[model samples]
Target: MEVRLFRRDETDLLQLSIDTLWAKNHVLSRDKQLLNYMFYDNPVSQEIFGEENYGFLGTWLDGRPIGLMGLMAFDLNVKGMKKFGFAPTNWIVPPEYRHTGAGLLLMREMFKWNPSVVLNLGITSNVARMYTGMGGYHVLPDVPRWIGLLQKRKTAEMLLNGDVKFLRFYQEITAVYNQTTYHVERRFDPERWNACYWATFAKRSIGFARGASFINWRYFQHPSFTYQLFTCMDDKGNYQGLMVLRIESILGGQAKIGRLVEFMANDQDSAICLANKVVEIGNENELLFIDFYCFSSISSWGLESVGFKRVLKSESDKLVVPTRFQPIDLETTHMMAALYVSKDVQKKISLIDDQAWYITKGDADQDRPN
Candidate 1:
């Protein structure tokens, strides 16, 4: 048995393991461009780990690939300092190989990279338990998912058995003054984005680095989905915030929904402007509802002010708004995550407080198409 890092050129081995063990016709196996876009073409990883150490760590038995684990590398912000971080994905060890300790081998190899932080977002309940048993990892059962109903009647019908009474306050919540200046663009302005980041988020927030390079690669270069970028500016035309959005059709095209994949703001006014822009987009396109999943209070307060309700666990089961839409799952869903912050980073930020972290659906592979 051999456990080692897979080079960028070993796509065949990675695809074989994914197709054989993960899913029969998985998109990663069928779409090499998407696969490369995720693990290899990531600008963050290329600059930090270089091409040789591109993300996959695989295990082989008798020279045949048996298991594989993919790591999506990014730069984590720790109170103005930049540090290496990675989110694990595509981790699989077939039933036959689970007993061989191959999964543990892959994990052990990953630790050798000495990442400052490891974010395991969108993990399963079983995987959450595994991380709990490992110790030193903080597991969040549910990341807060906020939803704003654009068309109350239609949204209630789709998710709540036509019970419009349950959403009576929808109008009040979606109300916005819309007094700020904003612009919609296909690409991010690097200079303005970096300036916004340094001025507001860099000195205070803790999360993935949201510079222009990250935004461009994450949204514009995506292989499967199209995202609209909305830049919020002050009356004087200075960049203050940005939002990333994607419209999706669900329920076999019976309904359409809007996804707010990323939200960042320098101040409350900018946040409200971005939130109002999303509402405008949703209404113009006639989407049933728009949802944003995030952890930071700083980034989400504006959203709440403009009518996005934090879907509590108690309300989620009853509302039944599906989170997965590529194939349209009707069941209630909650995104679970695990975070391992090194001692040095722990001193700089609080992992126990959800408000200290700024994470959105776009952070990892959560928003990808099936």
Candidate 2:
């Protein structure tokens, strides 16, 4: 068996890995829509993250390539933001090999290349336990709730009318030019991945200091998905909040499919005002499903009042895969899902279970846990 680094020059192997991740042996068979949304319509992101961030590893069994893994530096986005990187996003792996140690090997290879900041993305408890066995530490846990907002809402006529005051507010977004606070207000240039990713950090992780500017650029500006930024303006014309969106076309035809990339609210009234407009836009666009993530209950209230319902019924988390460095005996893990791994993003790559993650002990990979 052989395990090696991913070379971009190997287009056939890469495409084969990508296609396998997209289907065939995925955790959830219904993830094709999500993949189509991510790879097909969202060209900007596909171009930015596709071939670049992956640290591909191929494992050969019986002298034939049977397994593969793509180690993604999920945090190394824009050029400026590359400084703070993490091993959050994970691709596909064959089911048979997850219990083995190939998952750890793939992750170790990912760390060998990135070796930047800590990875804090969420993961299922089962996978987390395996990760603990592998040497990962507990950072933060988030639980994502599937939220639903009323499709039909009654908005304030004052905003719908867009009186003189509202017009001034709209004009103020571009007028106020304080690169410090208002820097968040700067329109994200599609050509500039740094600006877009940094802008995302400002609104998303206020305290988690460092982020990859280049990584951010690739998140929204790449060729895979289209990004739409909705900036907020106070009645006084001051900049308030920013919302990023990624839409995927679905076959159901209820406005296809729509997603709220990220939404941040500076204050209550400002949040209420901003949310009102977003729902209006969603209604106009005929969006089938609009999902939003809120950090605080206060901010969520505005979205809730506007008819959006909570998703998971609990604190929803942005989950990640099992880390490479989890400590085995410590066993500090989410008891409910100590070894859990989400079937969500796995549809994006194809990796033979054993080969995707290799173990020192060459054991048959027919047995898998979750």
Candidate 3:
């Protein structure tokens, strides 16, 4: 079998081609047209990573497809841990071929191709045992992340009582003061990285403006990730807070998507309103795995009231500022949050961080590897 990357303008993989290898995987149990959609399913996801390539390990016996398999690399950056590893993203093998060792053959080939790649498989059913038998370590049962499902009634209640503001492309959110909020407790802006970096965060280069711009590029328009941007304003048209959210999946027939990146909000009621509104919007588009950050530096109450579950919690340990920028005068502190997918399984799952894999291996290879 051959493993190839799909460049744009190449053949679209989502067609009527049938598959014997994928027929037994959990994903195929729900998707009959997976072979066709697999290629096109994660463009929004791949655009963030390099190509969202596949490990199409299929056996060509007598020139006919007999066995098939696939896997993806989780290429996110973790600062000091450059060679951290790759998640053994997805796998499929027909039940009839389960005892044939075809799975072992495909796995050895994948690892031999990249010795540095450590595998992270979802702890589901007997798959974990299969991976362990192949010399793969089981990453302890990760918390079951949960995203709040905002029903129509909850959304309507928020829209009626909570204030909603619309923001066009390049909107700015300038922090009115330098003080940190209650729940998030973000420290002063980092050296050189201020809030204005995000176009909407600041009009003039001041206080936290540069940091905001950095956030916009680092999250929304970054070359290796797809994210949804949100802004909140008070009834008087004053800038309040902004959030950046990306898609993530934590289960087989479902997705655990939530707000993995963001800054804090200015008020409680408005934040809850916007959170509900975003969940409702996500559902309208068939994305149910919805969640907010772990801390509410911006809007804490809304996420809690809407069934947002805090299954996992982590604190930022390091703050890596931009290159070529001078250090700022204020103290530096960083924070992070994550949410989960609520519903939907009609398409191929996109490994959320696969899109955020942009750290190059050229001269920067010494800094990190995955």
Candidate 4:
């Protein structure tokens, strides 16, 4: 087997590898709609993450691609200094060649590039174990928060199973939504990924260095998906929060799923207002449910107060359980795995807990159309 970095000229080869693997691989297979969106329609990876950082491929003795792993570049704020890191994604190996250790070989090559940090925000059970065995720590677990709108069956089932309690002062919670006088506006500026916009978010202790160029390439310029960006403002017109949303038509367009792609707020009040706006928009469009993944306790509390519920994966089944509300274990959450090679980056990681770092589905390729 041979391992190598993907050349810029091999995009078509990359696409062919992905399509051929997904179509023939037994462990996972996707429909053409997803396949097309993932590899064919969207060619923005190079422009968004930089051509040098996209990732690598493993080939058989005959030079046929048998394994693949992709990485997205991130300009990170490391203790107030700008640094670069990578988010590893789409790690795949065909079943027939699993025992040959092609996946591990690809991973070893990935670390050779020596990014400040290696972030894998979405890891399956098998991959999580593999990463742990490779000296990676599950730094952040993905606990997806949800608010059901038209999912009457699921909600009633939860209630009958003694999983929910009807609150007495529901009006008080609803009042929070009204207290913050916010004006929400939808925007579609291709040039929106500017330094000013990123500066607003950089106020946080740590986060992705999101700028206009990155945003346009990742969301607005995507070929097969449409993302709606909504900004909330106070009475004086100062920015309070922003929400990126995408409505996915499921069940052949008979129903839709409202996904809170990316959310950032200045305070609990802003978060509450943002949550309410999401619900309003979802309800207006008759969505089946509204769902999001967050690691912030304050944001979680604000969301729960306004119709949302926290759901964690069951140990025995991947199906969601109505877990008690609490701050999730950052180090054990498989979805939040991290491996830092630099001492400087490791110190920053220890300084702040996982929740202190800003993240959302939008950080990775997870929320994309694929």
Candidate 5:
């Protein structure tokens, strides 16, 4: 078996593996535009790996592809410095080929790139176990999830079958707020966004770089989902923060939900303003609830201050709220993650500290369509 990086022209071969092993109707398998948008059109990957170096790696036996692993390469921020990083996605090998060590081979090949960090978000329990047993990887059991109810009684009915007992206390917590000083816009201004990142988030944050190019490609240029961008500006008309949201229909359009994919701010005040704006938008749209998944104390504090309650582990285990809604899954689920940071990178920044990292559901393939 030969393990190597697949060329950009080999989409057919890669799609074959995805269709056969991952899922028959995955968006990546059939939508060439979406596939290229993810792997080929990434601005960060293009800058680091040249324009022609795509992110797919495959294991071929006798010139026939048998296994596949997709990598989403990006620039990681460490103490305001850019470092190469990648997240693995859609890694699969058919049962017939799993014993041949094709999976391991693909992983080893990825490591050959010598990325400063290898971060995996939205993983399964089985994959989590494997990552922990591998030694040198830091595994986070769950990334915190926060929910805010727009219409308490209606949300309770839709999510808990009219079990307003648990929501009685929160019912009085109204979504009404005084007009914010920040102005919100539905467009992307690349210059202002890059300036905001350099002036604020990059100075102290440790996570994926959120420059203008990344945001444009991840949210605006996405072919599968329609993401709405809420760009906040201060009284001086300076960029303060950004919030990416998507309104989803669940339970066969009987209910609507607000999914906050990305939340970035220049400071606590900006964060609070953005959070309040999200609540206002949710109420106006009559959404059942608004949910955000992230791993940052600053973000949590701001969200909680605006009435977003953390979804506890106990509640998640009991299926109090379902995370997946494309087809509506009722099973218990949490966002699991793992990170392998190089020793040099670890010295500069503490990737192990959840407080130091600014990860969101938008980080990897977590917010993608079903």
Candidate 6:
């Protein structure tokens, strides 16, 4: 078996694997648009990250594509300096190639490329084992999925009585808001990252280098998913923070799920304002629940103040059963990916505490087109 990265002109090979994976199991079809967005059309990638020249990982057996992995490049922020990292996504290996070690071969080739860091946001249990077992990489703690019940009475009662088989929640609960100083309004500005945004990044010890091009590619230009952007403004009408929200229908459209995909703020108060805005939006739509994923202590505190409950899970768990009252696998359980922080990169930033860095589902390919 020989492992090689897909050349820029070899998109046909990538599309072929996508077709094969989808034909074998329909669930893989959702990954097609996301893969395309990452490889071909992302403006940030084209302009800064040099994604056009970087080929995805593919393992060949006798000149036949047996396994593939989507690798996306991003400019990571370390001590305010720009560095590059590759996020491994959409790992595909058919059953016939699973035991042949094709996936591992491709991964080894990926590490040989020597990125400043390797971000694997959507890691499966099996893949997690494979990555960590290879050494020189550390696995982040599982990112807890928090849920805020729009109407807690019925759901709370169901939890206490052990009757968790439904996905519907009562819709009469009033949203509580603590952000009295600032107000929020819905906006369509994808290039809203300003000096304030870069200043926020400058203060961070570690995180991805966020900019307009990256934001537009990740959320605004997605082909199928519709995401809403909310801007927080002070009394003087200055932009204080930004938040991105998305709602998904599940259980055959019987349930509406809301997610706070990304949020960046100047302070705890601004974060609370953005979080409260999403809560109010969810209430207006009568959503069953609204959720957010992050490791930031400030954001977590603000979100909890607005009725969102912090849910935790073991790093080893495959499925996240957020609420016992109505357990549904509808929400994707995003495990922390394996990271390879080189000694040079580690010297510039601290990875000791996960909270030291800023992260969201938007960091990796988690909230992409699919």
Clashes of each: 1, 76, 46, 4, 0, 0
Q: Scored by CA lDDT, what does every candidate get?
A: 0.80, 0.39, 0.35, 0.58, 0.79, 0.65
Clashing pairs in 6: none
Superposed model 4: Cα runs more than 4 Å off: 22-54, 95-101, 139-144, 148-181, 188-200, 312-342, 351-354
Across 42-160, the per-residue lDDT of candidate 4 in tens digits comes to 34444443455334454554778888876666666654566766666677888998899887887787667556766677666666666665553444445455544445444324322
Please, what are the lDDT tens digits per residue for candidate 1 over residues 1-370?
8987777778887777788978998888888888899988999777755777657778989898788888999988876788878888867899988999999898888888888888888988998998897755889888888888777777777766777766664553465775545644445678988988877777777888888889989999999999999887776667888889999888788888898988888787777778778877887888988888886676787888887887755653444466776554555477899988788787777655656677788988888877
TM-score of each: 0.93, 0.52, 0.40, 0.74, 0.92, 0.81
Off by over 4 Å in 2: 18-22, 25-54, 60-66, 74-83, 87-101, 113-129, 132-134, 137-142, 146-148, 152-224, 233-239, 247-251, 254-257, 294-302, 312-370
Model 6: per-residue lDDT, tens digit, 37-70?
7765755455533555434677888887888777
Worst 10 residues of 5 by lDDT: 169-178
Poorly placed runs, candidate 3 (over 4 Å)? 1-18, 24-54, 80-89, 115-123, 132-134, 139-142, 147-227, 231-289, 292-307, 311-370
lDDT tens readout by residue for model 5, 65-157 = 888888899988875898879988867888898999999999899888888888889888888898898755988888888888778887767
RMSD in order of candidates: 2.3, 14.6, 16.5, 6.1, 2.2, 4.6
What ranges in model 6 sit over 4 Å off?
21-33, 47-55, 92-105, 153-181, 188-192, 235-237, 313-336, 351-354, 368-370
Q: Which ten residues in a row have the lowest lDDT in candidate 4?
A: 166-175
Q: Whole-model lDDT for model 3 versus the true structure? A: 0.35
RMSD versus native structure for model 2: 14.6
lDDT, model 1, position 342: 80
